[model samples]
Target: MAIRVTSEHDLIIEGGGMKIIDGRFGQPLYPSSPSTNHIVLLPENFLVSGTEQRISRRDFLSVLANVTRVMVRASYSTEPSAVYRLHSFSMQVANPSARGERRASAVEMCSCPPGYAGTSCEACIPGFRRVNGNLYNGVCEACHCHGHATQCHEVTGHCLDCSHHTTGPHCDTCLPGYYGNATRGSPADCQPCTCPLNLPSNNFSPTCHLGEEGELLCDQCQPGYTGPRCDRCSNGYYGKPVVPGGSCQPCDCHGNLDLSIPGSCDPSTGQCLRCRQGYGGAACDSCADGYYGDAITAKNCQPCQCHTNGSVYEVCNKETGQCPCKENVVGRQCDECMPNCWWDAERQECMPCHCSPHGSISQRCDVEGRCICRPGFVGRRCDLRRQGYERRETRRPVERVPIDTVQQRWGGPSRTGGCPRGAYRPKTGPLTHGITTGGQCVPCHCNSFGSKSFDCDETGQCRCQPGVTGPKCDRCSRGFFNFQEGGCTPCQCSHVGNNCDANTGQCICPPNAIGERCDRCAPNHWGHDITTGCKECGCSVIGSVTQQCNVNTGCCLCRDSFRGEKCNECQIGYRDFPQCTQCECNVSGSDSETCDMERGVCACADRTGKCSCKANVEGHNCGLL
Candidate 1:
């Protein structure tokens, strides 16, 4: 067997097992079990005798047999060949100088009990709990005081705070002064006691107890209370009870014995017993309706004067005769008219009517504002003037005569007698025979393009036809020409001309025209004709470089080769040439190199038949002999 020790008094045994056998034959010592294979323990107080402080085999067996109450001494000691095979064991101490403080001398099992430390459990350590078994055979654990306590009971592990309400080995139960649950896991479970409001302050019990189910339970009640709730007074009493066996007193009567009848006073509130006769109010000191004066003082009531037909009630106000008025009457006696009625001074009676200021004349209307209309007027409220009396101004009548009769009376229709060439008779009066008012012989103020004559019709208005206007019709109107024979013919100005003048009938030319009719070519233009409009000049760039040409004849003034009207075409003598070209005459014998442009004939210096030859040759037959 081998043994191990710790600083906390934990002992450990290791090996295959322990065996005891006979020495002579090497057989098992115990017959039933061949070998003893189990751990053994020794008491903490079992010690050795020498200065080395080690346990002997004899001493160890003796203590073991005594502790286990077994026959271990006989087997190991009697057998001469009995042998013990021990494994090695060693101990590591916290400090070698304090090796004496270690409990290594004691022998036990693998672990030590709580509060005991070192290999043999010989010493008790503070703040550790004994777990699993008694203090002799268990391990040491740190005591858990739940942070609220620093230490606890060594064996039972109860905390120690007197002021705390809970109780138990762990200080976890309700105390005498507190109530509610008092168990571990939760903190401060108990609460202070409070009695119900109906209980007297001095006589009430303040202590409470917790039931097994963790509910609060109160103590006994005071007097005059019966049930478990203790909220009500006992029987034979009406009001709240104050003392033990207490009962409420009866109410009193204030000299009016008739008012002391039953069913009047409330037992709890001590109010009136009953009211007598026609008295009302909480004290029964005032009078009732249909009677006047104080019922408590005078005691004799007087009647009121209210009109039977107009008053709403028989009873009236006590001081005044004012009663509830009817639908159409008011005042203290119920004798006056209502808001919509007026009193008539003469008739001495009330009448119902409404007169709006906008449509009536008086407050007390007779025929709905009896004068619906004023004097000499007829509509509502005298607002309209009467017919046949309307206001107007006087006007005189005018004398008239026919236009023909006025004409004949002035003179006659004859040229020497009647109105002049363009005149007619006046429409609204006798004709004035002369030109004093310009009334006689009124001209036909015709437009330029309106008419062909100056004589007006009988209405004294001028006559006008199309395209003419004026008093004499001598000129054209806006768009017409003034040609003499056609009278006022419509002007046919081309697109280049907008319109003709009224009197001259000439075209109002645009920028492209040079003549009054806009039919001529403009400056620096050529190739003008009636069929095509004027065109820009096309003078040759080399021959007539100026580009300007004659506007009337469309001819160019340049060299002979460039001879067309615009100087842009070649002449006869220079056919197919673009620029100026020299004539191709025989110049060796001719007077000039140029040729006739129309006939293509060359000029000669000899003055012969328009031909010249070399000097050594004969005339027409020079090439033959």
Candidate 2:
């Protein structure tokens, strides 16, 4: 058992065995021993005090139990011991012990309630709180609803609904021109107010009302009208709504006639007769001068009909249709002219027949009726004939001949020196007489070198050099061959055969072969002329057009001048043998040169050398001379 001494009193108790005491007026202070390891004791009222100065035995026992429990708890909280040993002892209890034990005080355990946490169980759950100290046991007594407060709480302090013109959780007031009903929700419900058309209002709310004459409410006067009611004309009218005492009045043209004369209609006469000649209108405030069309019209006088021509009637004073002239002429109509001639004022004519200087011409009159002299011959009557007349002749100068005409005539070389090569002259009359050949008259020679310079006299044949050809060797080369004045020039590599054809430089390639160089042949042809530089072939065929022709095939592709199996004979158009040298003359009197023997026709030179004619009259071979 243990004893507890409080600040006010002390307590004692017995342990291991408990005893009870009965009171005359109340329940017993002691009960049976505590069945559990720990027990608690509390006063019914915290303000009450014990009657005795010391604690009762039961209370002291309760405090001992608490102290034991606290010790056991503390011991359990410590780390376990590392070493251990055991000792055993036995004793028999013949009689129950009546001894008391003392122990220290103990503490009580604490447990938090639902929705509350902390050592004292004082705080409420999340999202639920107490404000202004109005909550207990973690329970809220009041709570803010929706979104109406600046600071919402589950207890006490909370904001109410917002005002009509204010919104948001803090009751923020809306600005002018804005309105809303959103107190606890989103701001989407807010909106601004609008006013009617032409009836603007700065106030958020506007009301409608009736205007004068049942018109809608208006702000200001409209055009041409005035007054608050807007029911009267401004001015310039003779009516009621704008009477003298009202907002507007009728125009007093009489008193306000600062621009014109004033007059009025006569009631008794029933006519607008009381006005001046130039005044009219209700108060004679306008022009009535029969309007002469412009400001120049007189106030009371009639308009002057001035002529458009600025002649005749300068100004029509009377209302008559005819116009009168102010002076001679110079008016609207043809009514006047100068006083010089027969003055016809109505016709504005003044005929003055005057003669010009050259003659009595009626067409030369001046504006004043005077005549002018004609050009080149001047006189008043213009009838005088001038003196002096004669005929003259003009001629161009003739050129004279100079004495050096003889030298100019015989300018060129005589005879041989002036003669052209390849042309001949007879050794007769002119040569025998030894006349000097002058002025383009010169003898001709066949040799290009000189006359009779390279001649073959006895043989009567031209011994042409290697590069020279032609009858007299006048031409260095013949046919398709070319020369540079003296000797024949070699042919281009692409040209073949003895001479290129006159019209074209293409080779006369043998049959079964082709190409400008004669280096190619048709398929199936074989020959050394194309392969071995113009070598003769000894194939089985003597002269076949096909390569390696057999004896049975005979000749092929005969020479142009001949036609035979061995190319040994000429064709019908050819006359001579061997090379078939013969001429062929056409009906036009043109002839071909001697032909090649192996070909079918003559190989003639076209437009080149002289020819052996078919009907000769003189000179070479077939001639008659």
Candidate 3:
């Protein structure tokens, strides 16, 4: 590479073998021309041999910084010859086809090569990092960030903005939950690990890697699933992994079996070996044949209590314990007769007692079929009103209620056997509730100021606010203080601080800190840092303009004639620090001054009080030459 020595010139490229010619004139340089020799044409201000002797290093670098475009030949010769040009990786040059064959362009410039840039390929592009201390070079390679980053460090070539679970300077390392060759430089090189199947967040396996044969080997499986590939259920767990979208499920014996003992049920089918007492089934979820009531919850099953004479079957409903009764019979045990009917012992059936529906509390009568009467009505049918009781018009049979309001209340005894809509489960309730949308119960009167929200969990414990403590969130946490309505304020006493005052919320500040927050330097100090704290100004009391300094840099307010950060030294050509006396040496005869202000050193004329005397005449101050 050649650089111009002055502002009047530009850089030049060394032309050895192949080179580029002007497109307008290069087309005529065919091999069939009469002349074979080509004359050398040079750029403007080019130094011909025997014209200029040397070039300096400083002038060479100036050429590279502001290089102009390269130019083709200015030769006057008309002879045509086969010519070559500078070709980038993508640049293709094709000689004109034989005379009559379909013609083609002599040259085509697709684009600069991967790492090359500028008009004459004078520099590297953004995608490529500099190798020769940030300058033009042909050996630069494209940015290799393993497809995780588009840009790299300009000086170090370290990749930046790496994504897709990648890390390291070149983004060639895979993060957890991923595997494959991260250095391949392709987006698909690194892939997510899947022991059995892939999922967005949680997976059956926690650690996996590609095996020697390229098969996936899971190092460890998450709970609820087992096996080398996490393809099978663990002991006491059940699932159908043979089918699509199937995940392992726990045995869930519902407190019927001792969970502490392993292998309580079949891992594939979830069949329990035995039940606690009245519970029996695949998961011991229902009552046995001889038992009734809930077997899964409450576990309060009782023996069947059906009346032998009225009930049709020996067994009752296992859940609700309602027995199958004969016709015209009602009650839990199926022993009572229906309304408006009486039992006939001889016929083993019920007989109806027809009564006036308007005057009687009910249509039923005595066992002998004699109709009973209401208080205000008379006769066996009770159709007539008595003495002072006047008959009123009766609007019989009310209309049905709307279906929307006929829904059940959550956790009501008759509805869900739990709690009310506004109330949550009792404290210390078992398991997360799927019944409530929050998966936990919440109650009213929960602390709104100190808690995360006005809600308590199933165990009746309120969620504490951020940086809060105490059961009722009345106190600040370890790193916080000054608790009030909104919340507590965090301590900011720098890294050296241990604690703060609880009531006042004042930070315990470091020894070097002057501010309460420890965010700024002390008076006469600067450059406050968390680890090192504030550094002393250390300025010279006499040489400094003032005691003040830059807070972040600790740079002193130096006097006009002083140099150095602390203003302790005088400027060049000065004599003293505090006084900063200028050197009065004359360069014409005294030579250049090398003043050491601290020692009061300066090159005076003749190394004496006055100038040296010449061969003929002499005086002082070099008056005679």
The C-alpha TM-scores of every prediction are 0.20, 0.15, 0.27
Candidate 1 per-residue lDDT over residues 78-160, each given as its tens digit: 33444443234433323323647455433344465555665446334665555554433456665554433445565666665
Can you tell me which runs of candidate 3 are displaced by over 4 Å? 1-121, 125-128, 136-151, 160-168, 174-178, 184-188, 198-207, 211-214, 219-222, 255-262, 274-625
Q: Find the candidate with the highest lDDT and give its number.
A: 3
Candidates sorted by lDDT, best first: 3, 1, 2
lDDT of 3: 0.59
On TM-score, the stronger of 2 and 3 is 3
Writing each residue's lDDT as its tens digit, candidate 3 over 200-248 gives 3336776677779877777788676776678777766778653557777
Each model's total of backbone clashes: 38, 30, 1
Q: RMSD, model 3, all Cα superposed?
A: 34.7
Model 2: runs farther than 4 Å from truth? 1-121, 124-138, 148-150, 153-156, 160-178, 187-625
The CA lDDT at 549 in model 3 is: 83
In model 3, the clashing pairs are: 19-85
Decide which is better by TM-score, 1 or 3.
3
CA lDDT of every candidate: 0.46, 0.36, 0.59
lDDT of residue 20 for candidate 3: 24
Lowest summed lDDT window (length 10), candidate 2: 69-78
